[model samples]
Target: MAGPSVLLPLRSSPFRRYLLGQLVSVPCSWAQVVALAWVVVELAPAAMGWVVALQFLPSLLLGPWFGAIADRYDRRWLLMAAEAGLGLTALAYAAVSLTGGLTLPVVCLLSALWGVINALDTPARRALVPMLVPPAQAPGAAALSGTVMLIGMTAGSGLGALMVTQVGVTATFTLNAASFLADVALLATIRVGPSPRLARAPRQIRDGFRYLWHTPRLRTPLLALSVVATFAFTFQVSVPIFMRASFDGGASLIGTAFTVSMAGSLVGTLVAAARGLPGRHTVARANLVMATAMIVTAAAPTVLVALISLTVAGVAWSFLLMSVIALLQTAEPAMMGRVMSLFALVLLGGTALGGPIASALAAAAGVRAPFALGALAAAVAVAIAWPGAVRPADRSSRHVTTADAG
Candidate 1:
């Protein structure tokens, strides 16, 4: 249902290039992800959670500092440097695997290294959007960005599985390594106004935290996200565990259900994109829908019903995420980098924690327990935030800037 207005952001040449480049880069990245997951699951299923945790731990530990860097430096250069690092890492992975040097410990180390580069890259990439387009189109741009990930999910998952099976892991890693060069090229062509170069202050990161803590419009949505995102958004780790435990990792069934969920995410993104930005109450509704889907996934007696529920969950989760991004964009442009970095912080931090939490809960209870716990946490958080969520979003600017407190 994305109409002409929804496509307005595409008219920006810089955004167009960025979107197109990501179209190529994202799927490749996804292919590597699937290949990597396959390696972990096959080699040491017991270590999957630790591997996942290592892969995202940098985001939790180093995210705010990198976000400060994003606020202070040219995002384009930072992104390019990250891509270069990614390419090197991918080649290293391919070399190690092809030479039969791949192991659980090596994988953990490599995952951690990648996480460091990603922690730096994520905030910069996220904060770059408003620079590419006008503020009003931020919602549409946000929607488009979501599409990039879904597209990756759609193409990347299938491709990843296929390549891992057919072409072998080294080829898959090499393929993704090549994509980074293309990304770097595209990023070089992008034109933008100067990035904010904040002065070297000791507490720049703390200022970001303080700004987020005080801004009700900013704080409430993230508060809801802290719960929902920590639980619902960790599908990558949970679903895999679910498949391995419940269905014994039936490849066809997992693929079918995962693809269905991606389709649902596609639907969710379109609906949210069409609506522009939803109010806070709407976000609460999305939470309930997602919680319901997770419950259904937990309780369904048959695979058919479980698959259907995942699709629905995907729809609701994607819908809620659009609002999260759009709401975050409401922050002042000067503060946009830090705000988006916090968004990444909460998001990736949840991801870092989600894997271990899912593994522990699933081990103690049943495989389905993580989904149920996620549902309960999300519902409770949304309820607590509901009162404030009903308030209309404040449109007035806070005049917050990175100019050393004026």
Candidate 2:
């Protein structure tokens, strides 16, 4: 018998409602990112690297603790409260900027606050998907989530630039705050079955770490993802610098480049979702493609060429991320929150470490230097992880009958 369509998860009312909320809020979040980055560049260009690093530091430090909370409590309420907290933070930023009191230090503090909220929010949000849809549709649901994020990012980058140029940074911040409120409202409408809560243990946070350490299936891919996150994900820092230094372009061009890359990601995510999740072998190849693309981006002589390379890199990135998420989600349903938090921790931790290093390299060598180093690092990661990653994933629980559909 034929299984459900790739878009089957969207048929679930709760999942659809959740996705719609993200469509509104994610773009706002991205717009805030663009505005904040530009704000940092304006205030202290040399500190841009540290600014980026500060945003992810909390996730590296507190991911497991938050994951434990998500496992023990209702994820839906956790997500709602997190969204409200994020909105309040954005409002505070807007108020500060409007009052002409926004400084580099303030920006860094707010960004760290945002990171803390995300550390609590991400695990619950990710772990909630499986509950919203059947197990078989989990991969498709994950891919769709990626697609929504990329599309939002694409729109937000472009719109953020426009807002910053015409309206002002305050407006961008305000929009982001409003978007979060909207997301909270939408989240209120979603109703899902209760999650299986774990009993209180003395060291519940350590359980996620212990699981990853013992489970080769989850551990290998996560380690690979961390490497990629550290090196390849430095594009947020690299791209704007590249635009200003190499192309002599301004905010608009940076936004355009981001949009092009996100468009590629959208395409790649849709393709992956429709075709079903790829195996570890495909993920390794995708990383190689990403490495090659970064090298190409570094060597490009013109802005047009760089944009093309970024698009290719985006495609490879989307594929790798979706594959990894699907693998983690399917591996252990009971420990989904903890496992996903570990994934977020590695990913964000890599960002925390890599952003500063890439920025310093860019400062010393050139803006293009980070891409070259990133390519090398990604290649090394592939070599280290390929053998384990290429082995077929255990998909024993992926099959779902129509009656079991959410």
Candidate 3:
């Protein structure tokens, strides 16, 4: 058989359908994010940070449990139900906006609810990717997924800005709600068989942790990722504030900045896809690049310079994200759901913890403070990861035990 090509995963009917659904749904999610940030900034500028934190709070609390559920249940049904629930939540937000009853508190409530749905969906969706393609194609599939998401985000942010400025927030929310429904429809067509059943085990969630503990190679990189996630991913909280406070720009400019960033992300994803999955040393190097980019972004004197810096940051960020995920998937195939959940927990939980700090820093020092903090955190992650990256492959390979084998 021929080795997997970049487009090989798309040839699978189930994966193709899932990709189509994501192409629509991810853009809507991005649009909603842009709209929600704008809405909070307009209604209660003081609560913007808190509102952003709320979106990730559920992931910190429920990620592990939900990941266990993904391992135990039918992922397709879980994903479908989550998509439906997301649609309802979007509709509720739209109704509130259209009725002139939208408030910061309401927005926060809805965002938390949305976060809960995501906590369930994310692990299941990730776990299903391997099931949809041949093992050799998994890396290509992951890259394709990342590329599609970035494309959606790029278009979605721009569309969201135009909708908010011209058609208003109500329209933006309504359109997002529709997109979820569309995703649900597409999901219904994917004809994958049920996942293999695992034997019921005591302390299933703890088992995932134990597995990680026994595997030093995986543990080191994941810990490094946790640090980076805490500091670097707080951009969602900082970007809007920076645009409004520092640059004196509005939604359109915010959307344009996001577009540029995602364009860079697309480039990074394509590079990783073409070259195949990166190893630990490459991921460590990507962290340093990300740190440099963040520092440059923080120091940018003009909006133009900031955008260029953000683009570089975006590229580095995408490379790091894809590399980490590919590493996790490659390391543990059987416990993928639980492992990925742990990954999600570290990343989202870090955001939950860091969002408020970033917001407070932005409130006090300036909007650019978080980027400086992110640079420091990234440097720390690089230091922690470097030794692991240089460790002998023979020793690292031996760490994969029978327990981790499928």
lDDT of 3 by residue, 202-285 (tens): 888888888766666567778888998888867778888888888898999888888788888888887777766675487788
All-Cα superposition RMSD per candidate: 2.3, 3.9, 2.6
Q: State in Å the error of residue 360, model 1.
A: 1.2
Best by lDDT: 2
Per-candidate clash tally: 0, 0, 0
- Superior by lDDT: candidate 1 or candidate 2: 2
The per-residue C-alpha lDDT of model 2 at residue 180 equals: 93
Q: After superposition, how far is residue 26 of candidate 2 from its true place, in Å?
A: 0.9
Model 2 lDDT per residue over 1-406, tens place: 0135777888989999999999999888888888887888778766877888888888899998888888888999999999999999999999999999999889989989988998888899999888898877788789888888888988888888888889988999999999999999999999999976877788667766777666666667778888889987787788888888899878788778888888888887877787676765767787898899999999999999999999998898888787778777765665788888888898887888888988899999999999998898779768867887645355775333222321
The lDDT for every candidate, in the order shown, is: 0.80, 0.83, 0.82
**Candidate 1 C-alpha lDDT tens digits along 1-406:** 2578999998999999998889888888877877887788778665777777887889889989998898899988898899889888888899999899999889999999998998888889988887888867777888898887787776777777778778888999999989888989999999988888777788788888888777777778888887887766666677777876787764444555667787788888888888876765877888889888888888877777878888899998888777787777777766777888888878888888888888788788988888898788768767956788734345455454534332
Off by over 4 Å in 3: 1-4, 390-406
| Candidate 3 to truth, TM | 0.94
At residue 130, candidate 2 shows an lDDT of 82
